[model samples]
Every structure is written in structure tokens, then in C-alpha cells.
Target: MVPQEAYRPDAGAMTTAIHVRGLTKRYGDVQAVGGLDLEIQKGEVFAILGPNGAGKSTTVEILEGYRKRDSGEVRVLGIDPQKPTREWRAKLGIVLQTANDAAELTVRETIRHFAAYYPMARDPEEVIAKVGLTEKADVRIRKLSGGQRRRVDVALGVIGNPELLFLDEPTTGFDPEARRQFWDLIKGLAAEGTTIVLTTHYLDEAEALAKRVAVIARGRIVAAGDPATLGGRATAKAKVTWADGLVETDTPTRTVLELSRRYDGEVPGLAITRPTLEDIYLTLIEAPE
Candidate 1:
């Protein structure tokens, strides 16, 4: 695991890594992206959350210069993605939702092969260790498990030592342990000043990695803020439940105190709950756009 110090950024420094204004995209009559505006800071891990066909992929593709937008101003790493240069492309690392790799190549060979493309690539052996693939380094790609293969995809993504990384559903097939390991790698990278943008269906993953989150729906961002407080979650009413009853109120602390007193210091089966990230995400996506 990466040391905790790596996650700390320079004190009070906020730089813009990605900027978008009046972004729009359409296919036939369907609007894929509609006037979406977003700004992500340097060295930040930002997550985009939304259901299928919600335009999350469309927006990301445009930002990556893989797709064209109908209208908008977009600047990634201080350059317009539409006019990508070799230097501009070199600074980016992208891990798509799915990729086709050379099935016959060993993990070590694959990493080495891709590393040659970057002028300042990381050491292949070190990259292998970072992604927890040292044991499978010599194994052919075709022989690895689904989750293990996913790790290779990540290894390739960070091999170039990119300044900005784009991860689309990065942990798709990872097991519980593997997922945790991947999170460590991401936190370590963020600590080292690599700006990361992530899109995932896992709310827990977003809460664990992203300092800020944006929820997209119907081709527009319906909500965006700190994951802990999105959609007024921070101040939403808490539910205090005990042995025989439950009460929803603004001050759960007061309710608990009264219950403790009434129960002579110990309330049976007492539980206090507030809106969780998943709860807020579901609510936001379901609301009318």
C-alpha cells in the first residue's frame, strides 16, 4: 500500500486540470450531452456517477478527443482536446471500459512493450509491483483470471507516467481484495500529483476515492459536490430507531440523549442513520431532469 503522505497536496494550491463550458453533443435527435459544464482541479480524484445511457461516456469521450462535441469549450491539461498534439497526448493515460489486448503476450512483456511508447515511462518491474501483478508477471494474458486481467489494463494505463489519467469503470471485474489494492494505487498516484477522473457504478468506490463527485442524467449534470454532502445529504434528517420505535428528526443527537435518559442510560437496539452516498445518488438520478 502507498504511504499516507502521498495523498497530501501542496497546502492551499488549487489548479484547474480540466475545464468545460456549454458542452453539447447529439446523435440524430438524441442529445447525448446538453450544455454540461465541469471543472476538475489538479491532483484531484474526481468521479462521475450516472446510470447507463446517461451521457457520462459521451462527455468523457469528447474530453479525451475520441469523439466530437456539437458545441462547447473544453480544455484538458491547458490544451484543447480537439486539437491534440503529440505532447498533449503523451500527458494522458486512458483505461477504457473494455480493451482488447494481445492474448499471447506475457504481462511483463506487455508492460515493457507499451512502456517503449512513452518517452518517460516508469520501470516495468516497479509498475508490475504497483498493480500487484508481480506473481503473474510471467503469465500469458490469456491465462489470467478476469480480475487479474483487469489489473494489467491498469498497469498499462499508468505505465506512461501520465499527468492526467482517465479511468472508465476501472475496477469492473476486480475482486474485493483486488479492488482495495487498486484504490491504494490510485490514492498513491493522486498523492504524487496525477490528476485522475473516474467513472463507476460503485458508489462505495466513488466515496472511497473521489474528493468530489458529479451526477449526470439525461445528458446534463443534475447534481455535483463533495460526495459526503451531495443533494443536501449532510443536513438531511437522521432516523433514530430503538427497540420499539423510530423517529426521523433534524437533531438525532438530542433524540438519542432523550432515549438514553428514558431507558436509564442504555437504549436497546438503538441505531442512528443518515443518508448514505448510494441513497443520495439514487435520489438524484430518479428526480425529474
Candidate 2:
């Protein structure tokens, strides 16, 4: 049942899917989250990147209503998760690293069972097919491969027909093909107006799936923006490389032109490159505390 006061999208909370300001959470002497701020729009695929213990878990848990925040404002779907209501919870889906251990049940049985809990669930068969589990729909959960099980987790996550989805390393056990398939599924979900909040260690996955990303370091956001240009990667020095050596320069075009004139055509083994998301990620994670 949708709560009139809580479930209205136009409740005048500034119209953001998820919003946070100065969020802080502490555990004794260790501050798990310190002054974090985030804003995710409707239908946006937002990714969070951080090293281990970088407050992603704490921050996200607070937002999900699984943990209490020590201070600051937090809102999800125009409702304060801190004081979550059934209607607010019904609008959200969470796909964690762990899944149900109902090994004896078949995939169809599991999905159908989970779907029963939501008032507005998607068709169980359609959910299974969307997660690439159609071939294994009748297979026992225990009989499935790790990747296939992960797909099941995804299926269960979205079966509710949620307005927002939290994906914590959703493709952990996926093979290359499975991972690509999952990405497509996520893209499809986003295209249909699902706001996805994703947390993953895989930089390429973040770059591929996220429209915007926030890099958390030392319990705070260090850098956030378009994945291609995060941390000034787009304007960062480019390296021109050849068989002999490599040189870093601001004007890679000019350097390439000089090298081209020097070689009179293709500079042997020549390549011009800028920092990749992974490169910038490494730097962001390794920055001095």
C-alpha cells in the first residue's frame, strides 16, 4: 500500500531521487562516514568507487535504512530512510553480495516466491529471462554456476518492479559474457526509469555503466563527475609513446605532429594515450591520507 504522505514524488523535497547532505556516521573512535553529500537524479545510474573501508558500506547502509546516521540529512524517494515506512521500502530494491541460500528450490520457484512479496512485482518469468536465467529457470539453485546464481540474485532484486535499485557488486561472480549481459540488463532497467545506485570495485564496469560517479576516499568524496573526465583525466597530460621511449606532455597533438614529421609517416610503434578510469582510480585510491 502506498502511503500518501511518503510515496508522493512531488512532495516538494526538491525532486531528487536520492539526496544527502553532510551525512556522518561514527563507530566509537573510527569515523565510518564523515560529511558525505550525494545527489542522484531520477533514472540516473550512479556508481560509488572506493578502496576497502572507504565508507561506501556505511554511507550506503545509512541511505538504505539499514543503519542509522549520526548526523545530517538523507532522503530516498522523497522519504527519510532514517524513518522508513513500508511504502518507502516497497519502492526500493537491494541486490547485495549475498543471495538466499535456498539451494533446493529451482530458479523459477525462487523468483516466483520472491515476487509474491511485492504488490507490484514484475512477471516472474520475465524477470528470470531479463537476468539471463531462462535456460536455468528450472534448475535447482545449488546446481547453477556461480555466475548463474549471481544472475538469480539480480532477478530477485528486480522482481519487485522497484523504482530504485541498489546494486552492491552485482556482477561479482559473472564471467565476461555474463557481465556484459548483466550490464545490458542494467541499461535496460535504467532506460525504463529505474534509478540505480551501484557500488563496485571494477573500474571498467563503473566506466561502462555509470552516467556519473563519486570516488570516496578516507570517508569522503574525493572526486566526482563523468567517468571519462573524472579527476581531470580529459585534460590531464597525455603520453606519446614509440619504440624508443615515451614522453608526457600537455600538448600531445603537437608532440605527435613533431614525431610524425620526424618519422615522416607512422612513428614506429607510436601511440598517444590519456589516463584511463582505472589509472585515475589508482591515483585516487593511493592519494596521501
Candidate 3:
């Protein structure tokens, strides 16, 4: 695993995959997005996090060409999404938060149907296998478990062999083990050089899958950086706790050593912790504009 600190914005000479400048959208009196600017590098797994009505959904929809933006420049895969061509659309894949309407088609049949839409599609059976649905390839969509049907959703998304994939809460209803399996599948896709844009409410999911994350609130980005370092979290003071005492300090190691010496051995119930990604996210979103 790459260390979290290694995900700095300027770590490499990266190519741009998606770029937006001064993006804005308004819904009557409420501004859904306001002057948002972002850039995602090729092959990077980037996450956008926010509560409902924070404009993340609007931003993502604009990038996906599902919604029109009022103003600002936007480019996805080097083409303006506003004027997307058939060829450009073919290069993208999307896995929405909700699964497609419950289908009667079997896994293999569904994959094959979507494969026909792309110019260079992966083999249907191969796509099914890639999503760990080989055993369920012959099963009808309505017959599979929730997690199994989710795997079918993923198979359809990837069958197009897209250069970029947008996953919107891909594991929303998944159990722990199922979520882990999904993460592995996503990692495999990222390793194959597919740029991924993920939107998830689960902070741990963002931390596990995204190299970098942007926190949006009230239609603006309040924080954007490596997940570990967002909102200065990486440098935040650690809280050192023991059986009867606790102290917050920049030098947690020194505090632990002192506690050990005072106790003449290991400190009882000793623990050290920094602010988690969730902790930082809460602060960012709840802060005043």
C-alpha cells in the first residue's frame, strides 16, 4: 500500500484527466454550485465528499454530461463535456448510487447488451469474471443478493473498457466483507490506469480508495488534499491517553515516554490517536462559510 503521505498534489508530472474552472450552477434563488474549480490527474482515484445539497452531485453530473452547467469551463478526458461526442461518451463509464431498475436479464446477458454500446468493449464473460460474478453469470438479476446484483452493476460499467470511471456511492448498502471485495475490484481497475472519480458518504471508504479528496460544503470546496492531511489532520496534535490521564500534544512520543518512565514500565491502557478523516470532514462541513 502506498503511504497516505505519498499522495501529495505535486508529487509527479501528472497528465490532466478532468479540469474545471469557475464552474457555477444556480437553481432559482439557491446556488447549487458557485465558482468551483478542480483538476484530476490521469489514473488518480479522486473522491468528492459532502452532505446532500452541497453541489458535489451537481458538479459530478456536469462532468458526466447528465446536467448542464450555467457557466464556466469544464473538460473531461480532454473534451468539453458540454459538447460531448459519441466517441467521447464511449470513453467513460458510470456506476450510479442506485442500481438500474431491477432487470429480468441474466448477468451475462446484461453485460452483453451494454457491451454493444461501446466501440471497444471487453468480453462479456471476462467482464463478469473481473467483477467476481463468474458463478452468477447465468443467474437472473432479480435472483441475486443485493451485493451480487451490485457486482452486476459494476460489470456493466466496466464492460465498455472506459479510460475514466465515475462511481457514485458504489457500495452504499454493502456489508463489511462485501465492501472490502468491492474495494479490491476498484483497486484492480485503478492499477490498470482507469481514472476514477468517487463520491461517497463513508469517510473510511474515501480514505481507503482515493489517493486525494476534496470536501465540499455549500457548493464550494472547503478543503482539498491528501485524505490524511486534509484540514491539517496529518500535523494535528495527537491525543495520548492512559488509565487515568489524557493529554493532547504535538509530541505524543515524548508524552508516552514520560508516562512510561513515571509508571516504571508500560503505561496502563495507553493509546495514541490523531484526528480521523471523519473528524476532519465534520469540522469542514460544519464550519461557517
Candidate number achieving the greatest TM-score relative to the actual structure: 2
Model 2, global lDDT: 0.90
lDDT by residue (1-289, candidate 3, tens digit) is 9887776533432478888989999999999999999989999999999999999989999999999999998888878888989998899998877765647888888888899999999999888888889988888898998888888878877889999999988898899999999999999999999999999999999999999999989998999999989999989999999999999999999999899999999899999999999999999999997
Q: Tens-digit lDDT track for model 2 on 1-289?
A: 8778785547555558998999998899999889999989888999999998999988888888999999998889988998999888878998887865999999999999999889899999899888878889999999998888888888888999999999998888677888898899999999998999999999999999999999998889999999989999999999989999899999988998998999899889988889999899999988997
Q: For all candidates, what are the clash counts?
A: 1, 0, 0
Candidate ranking under lDDT, highest first, comes to 1, 3, 2
Candidate 3, which ten residues in sequence have the lowest lDDT sum? 5-14
Each candidate structure's TM-score, on Cα atoms with residue i matched to residue i, is: 0.92, 0.92, 0.92
Please name the candidate that would achieve the greatest lDDT relative to the true structure. Answer: 1
Candidate 3 residue spans exceeding 4 A from truth: 1-14
Q: For residues 203-289, what per-residue lDDT tens digits would candidate 1 score against the true structure? A: 999999999999999999999999999999999999999999999999999999999889999999999999899999999999985
